[model samples]
Target chain A: MSEMTGWLLVWPILLPVLASALAVVAWGRERTQTLIGFAGLLAQFVAALALFVQVWAQGPLAMSMGGWAAPFGIALAADTLGAGLTLIATLVALAIAVYAWADSTPEQRSGGLFPLVLALMTGVAGAFLTSDIFNLYVWFEVTLISSFGLIVLGGRREQIDGAVKYAVLNLLATTLLLIAIGLLYGLTGTLNMADLAAKVAQLPPGAALESIALLFLVSLGMKAALFPLYFWLPAAYHTPLPAVSALFAALLTKVGVYALIRVFTTVFPEGFALTREAMAWAAAATMLLGALGALAEVDLRRLVSYTVVSGVGVMVAGLAIGSEAALLAAIFYIVHSIIISAALFMAAGLVVRSAGSADIEQLSGLYKGVPWLAVAFLLAGLSLAGVPPLAGFWPKVYLVQAGLDAGAHMLVVAVLLSGFLLLLTVGRSFALVFWREAESAATPASPAPGASAALAGGGRHLRYALGALVLLTLLLGLYAAPVVEVALRAASELRAPGPYFDAVLGTAELRP
Target chain B: MEPLIAIVVGALFAISVFLLLSGSLIRLVMGLFVLSNATHLLIFVAGRLTRENPPLIAEGMKVAEAGIANPLPQALILTAIVISFSLFAFVLVLTYRAHRSLHTVDTEAMRVAEPAPRAARLRGRDV
Candidate 1:
């Protein structure tokens, strides 16, 4: 039974790898690509759901790859938090695959894009599930490499430029992360995260540990695109195809945030009090700056990208609070942000495709021709702005409540102010695109055939996607009791490092 | 001998940092390569430079009886090397493409894709 439970932990990692391999072999055949992509996504979704169920029924699941134990061999573990993240990632991947199928051209579809997307999904799932710190680093590299391929797959000039910066910045982050992992291994004599968690504090505190912690924080911060490290994100995300952009906006930074939450809570809890405070301030600054940035942007895609930064700050603030309630809020906010961000990006794509521009200056009166798209955009935008009765509102309410509970008045203010700014930014775009009359008399009665056809099919698809997401978001908001219960359970598990250590080191005596 | 290797690794890291701080794109790429190698060396050092023997045990030998170098960090380093190799190759291609599109080899000149203006884009136009 224990062995079977262990194998359950490995399914998330295996599902994507198998799917990606099949996707690669079946490349250039659209039917095969779609079938492989959808089937893989469905399988991953089912596996993630089953994993969550098993974790809920039984406690956390652990597996050692190749029958080898931890510290010497790679391990994969899934707690409630990991299960939640896996669920979000799989659902988002599925939605993006569906969207990609609907939007991509025959040539775009043929260029092995599906395989790369599957590879990225596998990387993310692996990163979230892995128990070894070094394996986490490996999975991050997988994600980065796959992302680089996806970002530049279109071969557009702007995309190439964006991909270059994204690649360089991420590479720098990965190097820093590797150095930190090396230093950590030197100090702890273990690569397994659970083992490191147990042994990390037993070492004498000095410059070495401090430096390693700082290095890890900075590297993961850059990956999360927090505050000063976030300069690469807006431009890079804006240049990709909408579906790809949506996935990156939703999944990539959240992975970094997940790492931050995991390491801070479990491995480096002792020395992180001051660091959490600093992170709160950074989150505040990020929120304000990102909102201000969005307010200044004219392009819809770029505006949405900046909004990602703003949303990130809210989630970071939740993490920084470091209480059970705050952790719950962070989890809720992460799931909410991924869904809302993806929907908004897809809507922006639809507008760009229809109006022949991403700039709101040139786009007007879209509501008349594409009412469904407009409505989807409105719901997604309102949710992003944290309007009531939508998915976005609950996360904000929880986060703000958590802030107050933690006596973080400044973060509360930052959260409210950013919400206001988000409203203004998204509201302005809504007005320009959905309310204003078309500016050019020469503007066609309808969009071009390809754009129109996509718009017609895509409108229904976007509505369906947004409707499903909105339902989940609403359910999460309205009956957040169960989700909060799960989050608190996950938080307690994180707070107590004993199980993690035992799982990793077997029967070894704990030094502390 | 191990200390000497550590010194060389430190020097390599210093040189890489200097190159990274320089304004040339090519230098930056070279710097990244050097830094990756330095990290690889760091991992090698972390495994504790034992010259005794491989970690593999002989037939019928108990695990505790084998005095061998830790193989885990070496394995980690091998994986890191492969990842870094692919990263370097990809970055080279990106540099070529970026240079082709932007028509510059200077890192400073490649700042056309800054995020500030894009974020403040209230003047909506075709992106």
Candidate 2:
């Protein structure tokens, strides 16, 4: 009820903004920047945990800016789903900050990487917390711009090309998203999501509303790297610095997935049956195509990027199914994929640093030289393949179960086949990097100067980060019930719009 | 006035879409700019196109004749404009850099780096 109480929802969003400001001031001082990043990350993580506790204790929390209520002023809301995502985002951000500290070089330090990184985190956090539809667009742009900065920080030729394409395509998506927001605003006369959800149901099903929803689907679907819209992801994500790539691989696309899930479940539930079927088919195509692409790739980074495409299928399947179980599966898989894919990228970066090439054919016998990293890579790889007891298994089980319950046999089958393809992809990489004969291995005797320093000394930190992620992945698999429970609760709350609307619109009996 | 704004909006959308579909990166960037501007106009119109009144309420003004424009759409458009402008600038530089490095502005030519072959070997023989 209190404005200050509602302000707690904004902490995750504000943390990165403050950090970005600090990072700008701390530019040119590496130690200062590193300390700022660490302190900011720690503070955000603690704040996120506390906010989660508050959300758990309290129902949905809403904060209106300048003391104006919904339909008049901008507001921010945090539901259970938002809270859960904020928690994962902050934790992943902390891991990335620590990893960057351990791995960054003096050149990277001078390149303004830290500031961009903080800004990127801020954008992602803001996108998750903001309650207004228009504000979501703004937050999304914030994420996109910072992502551009992060991708191009090193100024590598490849990084520039990839970043350009990424920037251009995402700009297009953002434009479409803006159009959709405008259409929705025009029709409903309200930009607040809760208010729109309530009003939209009263509007007649027509071309304008349908177009708005379709536009949103296209835009957010591109962001989620759904099948046909995914061409930019593999190349763009493959070129950035490992830490940046890792974080993006883990978090950025998932934001798209999160947005899709949130909007589909909350605002567009009436037409969701048809939407789900469409999405399920897209999920199938995406899964099969992504796996086949991953199977074809020889570059480790690009292979991981392709896997991201395939992984999107799992989340899409969960979303399209729309069952409580399916939603839970999607949430579980999203968290698992974030941790595993990040660790895998970090490991691949180590390989690139040591072997001087990300070309799988050119690097071999890393298992002998870097046992710890090899182990971490194998764990992430297996988990991604959905091997038992790892993070990936539980989500697949639930998703398949949901598909069966919903009588979506083809989707279930597609999900299983993609899992096997992922296995083959991971197995092939492991064999090439670990099991091949040394003479047949491609190992660069000496990498470019400073590569070793960047790659090797961070073993302790990488180990710690990798261990933490792997531990969470395994624990999530083993203890899937609590996570599933949280996801189900969130999903049910999303499915039922009455409570959310009541909370935002002050319990007024508005005309239907 | 509404009809004229609609016509301009339609023109912007057409030009933007045409440019976006073109192969030139520079044109594509311009397309994005035009498209975003059109979107902002659309949002403004969607908020019902007030001409005589501003969004602010003066002191001692009564509710009956206040007739202010909705400030929310204005705020949203301003934010969108700034955000899109910054994005446009960033992409412009990025496109320049990409053209310089990749030696071609043709997106078709940028596809040279294929995934490494799976059977390729590493450099070090002795583990």
lDDT of 2 by residue, A128-211 (tens): 877778888888888888888888877888888788788988889988999888888878888778878778889998877887
Q: Which ten residues in a row have the lowest lDDT in candidate 2 chain B?
A: B112-121
TM-score of chain B of each: 0.81, 0.78
| lDDT tens readout by residue for model 1, A204-316 | 87788877877878898889988889988986898888889989998999999899888777778865555766788888988989999898787889899999999889888
Error of 2 at B94 (Å): 1.4
Pull out the clashing pairs in model 2: A361-B120, A361-B121, A362-B122, A441-B122, A442-B121, A442-B122, A442-B123, A443-B122, A443-B123, A443-B124
- DockQ of all predictions against the true structure, Cα-based: 0.48, 0.50
Q: Which ranges of candidate 1 are over 4 A from the true structure?
A: A441-454, A457-459, A500-512, B52-69, B111-127
List where candidate 2 sits over 4 angstroms from the true fold.
A1-4, A272-274, A440-455, A506-512, B53-71, B112-127
TM-score of chain A of 2: 0.95
Evaluated on chain B only, candidate 1 has a TM-score of 0.81
Alpha-carbon error at B62 in model 2, in Å? 8.8
Question: RMSD to native for every prediction?
Answer: 3.7, 3.8
